[model samples]
Each structure stands twice: as structure tokens, then as C-alpha cells.
Target: MTWRWLLLLISLTACQGPDQGDPYRPYLRVADKDDVPTLDPARGYDTASWQFEDLIFETLVDYNDEGQIIGELAQQWKAEANGTRFVFRLRDDAMFSHGRQVTAEDVRFAITRVLAPETGSPGRDFFLSVRGARTCDKPGCEVAGLVTLDNKTLVVEVEQPDPLFLHKMALPFASAVPPEIIVREGENFDFRPVGTGPFLLAERVAGQRLVLKPNPYYRGAVQPRLPGIVRFVGVPEDLAWMRYRAGLLDLAIIPPAEIPIVLRDPKLSRLLRTADTLRTQYVGLNCARPPFTDVRVRQAMNYAIDRRKLIAILHHRASPPQGIVPPTMPGYPQRPEPYPFDPPRALKLLQAAGLGGGFQATLWLRNDETAIRVAQSLQQDWERVGVRVRLKPVAWGPFLDAVRHNPNIDMFLLGWEADFPDPSNFLEVLFHSRQIGANNHTYYSNPVVDALLEQAASTTEPAQRTELYLLAEQRILDDAPWVLLYHPRTMLLSSDRLRGLRLHAWRPPRLAQLWFAEEKTEE
Candidate 1:
């Protein structure tokens, strides 16, 4: 057993160690976030997976690390007179890893796949808002929201006036696909991904490692400093740090709990730093089933949990949130009084809902050390309201699968980092009634809230967009769809030798921008 353990450690070290391919170029050291669930962009929704996709694949337009609109495949675009027709012109030189120039047809295919019911894409909700997008799901998207006008220009029509559609197009789901690969292989194409980004998928070994080499046809001014990125997964958090310290891993992700330890170390203090962001965390109440089915019960449960305790337990690494949209969000209005952490108030609501002594229920959460701790604290807090909470802690993979299999839990902890700096990403995706099934774990539905979110998404004017979101946020909070928790402050630790590891303007660390310092020889 000891030898086996030793071999496993050695393998991880080798997997994360700096590549010997290019001694002149320094590869950024990053912790392998987690096992990537899938590569089919439409299929899974994991942050770590998105981190890779953020580099490997891109949309017609892009949001830089600062969340600013930048061009990727689509060099430039224009909207037709009616404001319904959008024409995006692809770069003439853009080519996939297979050496094929990306075309309007590929964009048409990718968008349709996301909207197709057959694929069960998590992003379907966001795209379905486009005119005729739902039509693609049932039969074909031929006459749906999109059109392949030519090889270079693709157009889309929305049901309503949506000026912000272009902004949303800058996000990932709307990204153009390599039609040849996805069509020829189907599921097999997932393992062998081909994209037109700064990086190309080099190698992937299941439950082990993934490597990305720079795209030869990359169309960027500042070329990626690293020749290739090799990602190793399932490295335990503590072991990940140890591996980094041993110079086996280049980038180490320091969890909120370990931030202090990394900062205190003299060798590590220079490497350790904070990457702040408005990363919201919450427990989604299973509003589709009984107990939580009653809005008052949901509200009661919300009041039962102490938001302050949650942030404190997490080492003040998060800000309390009254709803999905935090105050930092552009259009969010400050709610003076949050859901008070009063057990008596909770009892009253439960009693009013005809459950005076509270009820027995199960709350689900990812089986990580930190997630389990949060769930345990929630259980303890709700118990004070006479709510007997059963804790269901499963590993991240199984937990997400179980929740999607059946949205029947009384509650489950969920984390959402902004996909784009937009309110619709927060409201419509989670609370929209049509967005249920595998992706919509909350099972939230309210006609009024839905309308507001739709209105917000379509409105192009910044002020008007904010107003709609303000209403939407208030509505969701008053109804207590989920026990809104806290917005997390991302804490990152790096080696003193690493530079530019700071959180990008778009909110998360830009893996592509990280650089290593030059080594010194002994005197």
C-alpha cells in the first residue's frame, strides 16, 4: 500500500511538473481545478471545465478577463435595420486545429446543438430566448433564431427588441463549433475536441490529465507565453499544495481556509496573493417538491439560516447575499433588511404554512471538506427552527448527477460565478421555469420574475437593464426561491516566482496570462 501510494504521488508530481518541451518558455503553474466532467461545451456546467473552455474555445465575440467585449473568431459585426437581424463576420484567416477556416455554418451548428432538446444542453435556456430557438429542439433550427447567410456572416433574430444580444453573443455557448468533428464523431468528438482558440486540445487521459498546446493559427497579438498547459485532476487540496511546494506544480489554488497558512510562510508569502471577485454561493431550495414547494416554507427556511455565521465560518471570505444578484451587481438595489436570522420568525412562517413543529427534510451538498462544513452548519441552524435536516453529502460528480436526476431535495448548496457580467446569467438561468431538469436544480418558477428577467435581457440600455434586474432580484428574494447565502471572495496563492496571477477584469484568474520569473544561479 505504501509503495502504491508512493507511485501515485510520483505520478501526480510528473503530471503537474513543468514540461521539458520548451525550456525557454515558462508554463504557468495552476492547480488542476478538478476532474473535467466533459468537453462538449453544451453538455456539462463545471467551473473547472469552463476554465479550460475559456481558452480552448471562443465565441464570435469575447469578454476579456475584465468582462469587456473583445473579438475572438468574429472580427467585426453589424445589426440589420430592424434590430432583429444580426450579422457577424468571421476573420478570413480563422482556422480550426484541423486547419479548416471557421464558417457561419459552424456557428449555426453549435447554436442549434445547444438549443436541441436531444443534446440536453445546460445552456439551452439562455439561447432559447432567441427567436425560434425552441423550434430547433423539436424538429430543426432551420427557421429558428439563426441563419447561415454566408460562410463568413451568420445572423440571428430575437422574438423581441434585444440590443444586448450582441453582448450575450460574446459568451461561450454562442461560440462557433468545429462542425466536422462534432458531426462526424458525436460523443466521441467530446474526447477529441477541435477549436479555433489560442490553445488547441493536445491530449486527454480520463481521470488523469489534459494538455493544451498553442494553436499554430492563433490570431492574437500577444502569443501565449507557455508552449503548452498540462492539467492534472483529483489531486487532493492538501496534496496539491505540497506538490506545489515541492516544485512539482506551477500554480496552486489555495482554498479560503488555507490562504492564511500560505501567506504566513516566508517562501510562500511572495507567491501567495488574493484574487477578489463577486463569486456568489448559495443553497438552492428544491422548490419543485413538497415542503419547499410552499413559498412560505422556503421563506421560513431562508430566515432560519444565519448568513453571518456562514461568512464567519468561511473566514469572512464571503459577503452575505439577500438574493441571487449581489449589491456589487450593476442593477441590484440594496435591501435594507436581509432575511433576519431569527428562529422565532422562522417558526411563525412554518406554523403559518401549517407545519408548526417544522418538518423532516434532506439537504444536499457537494462532498468537499468545505462544502460539507457549510451543509453541517446549515443543518444545525435549521434545527433551531424545529426543522430536522438530513445532510446528504456526495462527491461533486455524483452530487450534481443526483440533483439533475431528480430535483426533489428540500435544499442543496450551489455556487455560481458570473458567466458574463450580466444579470440575466444570474436570474433567467436559475429561476426560469423552462430551465428545469438537469441544469435547473432549483426548480424555481414565477411568472412575474420570469417576465422581469426576460425584459432585462432584451433591454440594451444600461439603466433600463438595471431597473428590470432590480425588480427581478427583489421578487426572487421576497419569494425566497433559495436560501440566498453569500458572495465568495476568491483567494489565490502563487509562488513568488509567478507574476500576473491576479484575478482578471472578468472576475476569475486568466490562465493564459500567467508568467513565471527567471531563475537565478548560485554565486
Candidate 2:
């Protein structure tokens, strides 16, 4: 390790230890970089919000460790009408934290709430396949497709046979919320949410911290063994590492700069955990704007960067991306490199696109240290190919707002994590023209790609669906709306006192499964 990093680690080790007053406290303390924006499932979209939502809310279905969809609130479900209609049987013992019995009506209300235009849920597009969802815009409009036959039984019908409907049902957007609570709390419901999950939100101190306690009414297969979970929010990665070494945090995300140092330390290396995630980090080129409007320019941008060097900058914590679809997802084509590191080819393409003299464009990105470093690398790489790049660093929330709302944004660095273990989550949700203003920030449009995505969505046969997705993905790659960067692997350091903490490929960590070593004997 470098002398500078070694001295930094030594200084961190010299700090005082964690508070001794809580030595016997059973709550697992964690350090998070940002505060959760919302706890309501319908409004929560970011990773920080999803982590808390996953703990406090219960979806109808969930993914098993094997990546298969399994029942959660719904004990059993059957597809009928050629996979167009689904009937779900809820568990009779499921009860919300507010002492209300979870019922079919609650499930129906939760889904319809997302479809309601008043809700303004970004996830509304995910549920557009449900019948009557498109037309149900007004508040309090009953969706004709969602039927509550009994307290424990519900039925959902779609406009067409959707092979991944069950997968969509497993998302946090489809989490069940009590209708009574919504009626009573109204807009305040986002903060005072009550659900049938393993944990209940005990306290939230805005930008400081959040405390969660076990839900007594939770009847899930695996019970929460930890007494509670405490998250120290708004803690920067550098401070988080120092706090982790001082024993204040049970878990901390290893920042890019500190990763090598941690790996070199024998004791810290033993606490380090790494796992490949279904996420893709890329630079989005605005296809609707100047320069990038030409397909050749977009392809040139992709060819300019050396992915291997980018991975090296990340300390080899990421793999070179083959395409938009991550390798972990099914139907990912193992094709030849689409755009290798060839600055000459990139300059030639730019010249053909009438930009031989080079053009200036601003690249917007998150202000985080890691993002800034990557952006700097990209700026250096593009400069070699006669592309003058200006970097604009903004905070995470404002950065997303500028990308989504500002038409002047030329290019931006972002990452997309798979919401479901399907290629459509990457291909269709990103490249489909219908998703332009939503997840498709590039505003790319291709009729052939859209048709293939539609066909794949309705195709019930897995093999045929995979083929259609592959075709759409290839078309998207040819379009080159994004300069594909790398697929990052999640790296975290956990305290030795914590056990049963595993990183999932796509979903949030299963907090219910985590327990302290001291508590394991009691269990």
C-alpha cells in the first residue's frame, strides 16, 4: 500500500473506540452515505429508500437465494388465461405492524395507489401491463382488473400475457399498504407507513439517523434475530471508514481509494466481503441533442474509452461490460466486443460525422469522489480523440434532476441496478422508446427495438422470450445511446461481531437474517 494510505489507516486506528455505554446493545449499527428520501413504497426509487422500504414493507412475491420468484405475503398464486390472469392466496396469519390483518383489498389498494395519477409514482410504467391501468388516471378510480374475491384472495388481470408479471409483482412498488392507514394519514402516510414486514420504523431523525425495531406481527418464514437496526445516515465514505475502524459501525461500504489499503491489511481483509451485482455504470449520451444526434458520434464516444483502464481505476472491483444487460441476467449474449479501445477508429468516426475539428460538450456527474475520478479519466480519454469535454459535478439528487428534466444536459454518468432478474429490466426498460422520459434518459427511439421488446414481454415461452430480448439488446448496442463502462461488484466491510450478512445480487440485504454472534447462541 502507498505511504499516504498507510498513514491514513494508522491515524484512523489511533481514534477512540465506539461508545462503551452500548456495548451490550443488540442493534446492528451501519453507516450509510445518504438519507432516505422517502419510506413510502410508491415514492421510494433510490437505493437508500429501497433498503428501508424492503425492511418495513412486504411485497406479494420475493426472490429466493436461487433467483427464483417465491411467495411472500401471498402464500400461493396460480396463473390462468394463458398467463394473462393471476390469482393470489394471501397468508391468513399476515398482520400489519398497526395491528390490522393484511387482506386482499390492501393488496389491491397498494397497486392501484401506484397507478393513480395523483400518486405520481415513477413506477407506474412498470404496472402499465395491468388492465385498466392506462385509463385509471383520476383519483379514487377503481381498476377493473384488480379483484378482491375474499379477505385472503385477490385476482389480477393483464391486457396481454406477460411472462414477467410475477417478477414485477415482487418489486417494492407493489408492496401492500393498509387502505385504512392511507385514508387516515393521507399525505403524511409516507412518513407514518405501517406494513407487514420484519421491521418497523421506530424513529427517523431527518438527515441524522434512523432506528428500526422488529415487527411483533411479522409472520414471515424467517424471523428477525437482531433486536433492531440503526443506520447512521449522511455519513461520507471516508468518515464511514474511520468510524468503522473505531467500531462505531457494524458495516461500511469500502470506498474506491480505501479498497486497496483494506485488502493489504490482514485483519481488515478478513472482514471485507465482495459480490458481483447486477448493475451497469455508463455515460449516457443525449441522442436528442447535438453531436450525439448522429449515431456515428455515439459509437465514437463508446470506442474512445478503454474499459480495462477504467476497471483498473476501480481497483479491479468491476468487470468490463459486454453490453447494457449485465452478465448475471439470463439472455445476456456473449458476443464479441462491440467497441474496443481504438482512438483512431473513434477519431475517424467523428470526422465522418462532420466533427473532425472536435466539438466541446459538458459531462454532468455526481460530485462523489469516485464519480469525479471516473469522469476525469473519461475527460482525459476523450481529449485524446479530439473531443474537448467539460465536467460538471453536482450532488446526487440535483444531478438526477438535471439529467431527467434539463434538456440541455449533453452527457451524464449514471448507473442502473436490475429491479428484476430479467434481461427486459436492462434492455426494454432502458432502450424502449416508451421509456424515454422515465428510465431511458437518453431519449433513444427505435421502432424495431420497441417491437422486439413488446414481443418478448408477451411471449410466455422462456426460450422465445430470450431470443427476442437478445435481438432487442443487439439493436440497442448498435444504437449506442450509452458509452458502456463497467459492471461494479459490491464491496463492504462487516464487523466480526455480525453474522448472516450476505450481499444479494439485485435486492437489498436481507436484514431479517442478520444476527450478532452473541445472539446466535440464544437462537
Candidate 3:
């Protein structure tokens, strides 16, 4: 058996003890993102970030508590002619939160609008790498391949046949949105979501909280066992701990800063820490631009970092990241060795790049305290090598805008997490020259790297795909566009009563399948 399955089997054995054992509990108050701009799937970034969103609207496919994609809205699915084309057979009983039946047409409309630029959707970045996506971007555009043949059958054609297509369908952007709400309403759809997922939005207060209640109109009784409500409290990770301690919250995702204190309490025995393989924190080099244009300059910077110290800052719980994909992920070429903290080597390389004398470079960072800390560390580290660094700090939202949409820095700090477990999800989207949008601040690309990713995406065979990914991963490690730092670990602190909680591929805190003890409920 593969390592993924092996880990899953061992991890899940604990939750499967006895069916009649514990009753699943309902409400969970948790830390949340800054905002979910709209409920319209096409236009929103964090719209579906909260667990409440997951219940209110679901993708055609969804991850179980373990982070593996299980059929959610698409009860049964099949791809035709050797996985080149896909035909999802929808559950006949599936219906939107509104009384309308969910037809194949709704899925097609939702996906097509994502490729439509004028919708003002950030999800556009997610699909640009999709096959046949170019046609949608043309002046008089049309997304050629998607079709709804009947009420239940949805067929999609791709320019290049990709085996990962079905898995990609399981991502948030591919989640089914109501054709009537997302399309007809546009901006107005944020207040009202028309979906076929597990829950419905009850009420939302800006800058404070967002609440979701179980959708009564949902069909089929096979659903999340805990069915009351999921609320996301928009507060810093520090405050989230206090809420959890006060019994006002059941779970809180431990951010880097909070790991130290969260681990201190003997009360956090239920704390679960897992490799969040999705995001990789690193310093990005603008290969074609500015002071970072020289490869030696990039390498010099690499020699100056201390991954051990970075992990120490994160409280030593997270796996010091080896590469973009962890060793747990398939096709790891090799564990990424830690860069030597050699200021002399860094200085020599800088000299080789004709930058021996100190040159001023901007260290762009978001306004978060953590980002500021990381920036401060690098600022001091490189200063020893005669690289004077000016810190460019901006608030999180505008910070992303400056990094992605417009190029404004010599070196930029960033993080990347996989939407799916696939290597193509890591290599193709960020590194593929084709996908360098406002989101891809790094313009680095190579034809060989692109070819390997294309080969991997073209075939469905896991072995062949793994081989291609391994080769591709090695290429990037050598290229070194970004220094691979430690993999962030997510620590979940909840009561012992919180059973069957799973932090899946995206680190989305799923409240489904959890049970409250009968003993605890009475107390």
C-alpha cells in the first residue's frame, strides 16, 4: 500500500472504534478569515473559506474528514474512453437549497463563468491552466468543451486529455454553483447563496462573524452527523485560543505564533498536529527582473537562511519542509537538505553575480506580525553579507495585490499550498509559464519543467504520474526560484468530546462526522 493510505489507515483506526460509542456534536465556534466577499462561487476568494460555506455549498466532489475526495454532490461518477473525457452521473435526488432540482446545466454554467474575465472573480487564476481554457480568454470568447447532455449527465472535453481532471473537479473552483444565483444575480448573489451542499447561510455580520445552519432543503439523509451550526469568528489566532479555553469554542487552528502557548497547556491533549502540505513558505526570486535576475544572487540568498531557526519560530511542531511537496507526498525526488548558514558563501556568490558591494533590495511582507518577524530575520541575515534590505510592508489584502497583479519587488516572500494532492497541482499552476497571472508573482519557467508537468497531467496512471512529478520536483529544487522553508503544521485544539475531526488537503476545518459524548452533553 502507498504511504498515503498507510498513514490514513493508522490515523483513522482510532476514530472507527465503535459506531454506538459517541453521538456527534453540532456547533463549533472557530477562528476565521478576514472576509468572505460573496457567496457567488465565481467571484469570491474566501467566500467558501468557512466550514459554514462547506455545508451551505459543496463541490461535485469533496474530501472526507481525512482529506481524501469522496463523492458529495456527485453520488456516482465515471469518465469515458480511458479518462480523456468525464461524465459525472449526478445523484437523482440532489436539489438546491432552494426547492429547484440541480441539473447538469448548473455545473456547466458555474465553470464557464469562472473563465469569463468580466465576472471579477479571483477563481480565474485557478482555471487558466485547465485544458481548452485559452478559448475562453480570447476576445470573442467561448469555453468550447463543457456540455450538459441530459438532466443527470455532464460531459467535458479537454484540449489535452488529462487524468487528473476528475480530481481537479473536486477543488473549490469546480464546486457546483447554482446557475440561477451565480449567473443571473452576479454581485447580488453574495447575500443569497443558491446551492445544493450540506448547509445554508443563516446570518452574516461584516468584520465580526459569519454563521451557517444546516440546509433543511438538502436531499438524501446521508449527511454530516453534526447538523446544528458552524460559526467562524473573525479574530486573530491569539484570541481564538482564549475562546477555546473559555468553552465558547470547540476548535481553533493554531497559527505559527500560537503553537508555543497552545502546546504548553496540559489541557490540549486533544491537540492534533498534521503536515499542512498545501502551503510552502519561501522567498521568491524574480529571475527575469532586477537584482534577483542573476542565479548566483538567488543562490547566495539561499545560503543565508536557517530553516531550523524558522521552524523554531513556529514552535518546532511543523515538519521542517524538504521541498514543495513533503516526503509524505508522492514522487519526492529527495528530502530537501537544509541550506548552510554560510554568510561567506553567500557573499562570494553575490560577488560572482557582480553584486559584491552591498545593494539595496526590498523585502516585501504583509502586515502580519509573523511576516514582519520573518522579514526582520532575513533583513539581519543578509545585512551580514552586505545586502541592505528595506522592508516593504502592506496590509494582507493589498499586499497580495502588489505581489501578484503588478510586479514591484526584487525579492518577495510568499506561501503556496496544494488545492489537491497531485504534483501537477504544485508544479503546473505556479511554475508553468502559462499560469503566471496577477497571482503568480514569480515569472520563472523552463521548457523541460513544463514538458514533465504536461506528461504527468496527460496520463492517469499513478506510477507514470509519480515518475514525472519526481523529475519535475528535482528540476525546481535545482532552479531554486524560491527557498523551500518548513512545512506549516496545523494544530487542532478541541475538547475530548470532539471526535472524528479531520483536517484535509486544504486544512479546511471540517465539523462533519464529529460526535459529542453523551456524558459530556449532560454536563
**Best candidate, TM-score:** 2
lDDT of each: 0.73, 0.86, 0.67
Candidate 1 worst ten-residue window by lDDT? 16-25
Q: Which stretches of candidate 3 lie over 4 Å from their true place?
A: 1-26, 37-39, 43-53, 66-69, 120-133, 137-144, 220-234, 255-264, 271-278, 331-333, 459-464, 505-507, 515-523
Q: Give the candidates in order of lDDT, highest first.
A: 2, 1, 3
lDDT tens digits by residue: candidate 3, 493-517:
7765667676665646666556565
In the range 53-169, model 2's lDDT, one tens digit per residue, is: 999998999988768888999999999998889999999999999888999988888898888878878788898888888888754468878888999999999999887799899
**TM-scores for every candidate against the unseen true structure:** 0.89, 0.93, 0.84
Choose the strongest candidate by lDDT: 2
Structure candidate 1, residue pairs in collision: 29-250, 29-251, 30-251, 65-505, 65-506, 66-505, 66-506, 271-494, 271-495, 271-496
Ranking by TM-score: 2, 1, 3
**TM-score for candidate 1, residues paired by index:** 0.89
Which 10 successive residues of model 3 have the least lDDT summed? Answer: 16-25
What does the lDDT read for residue 181 in candidate 2?
Answer: 85
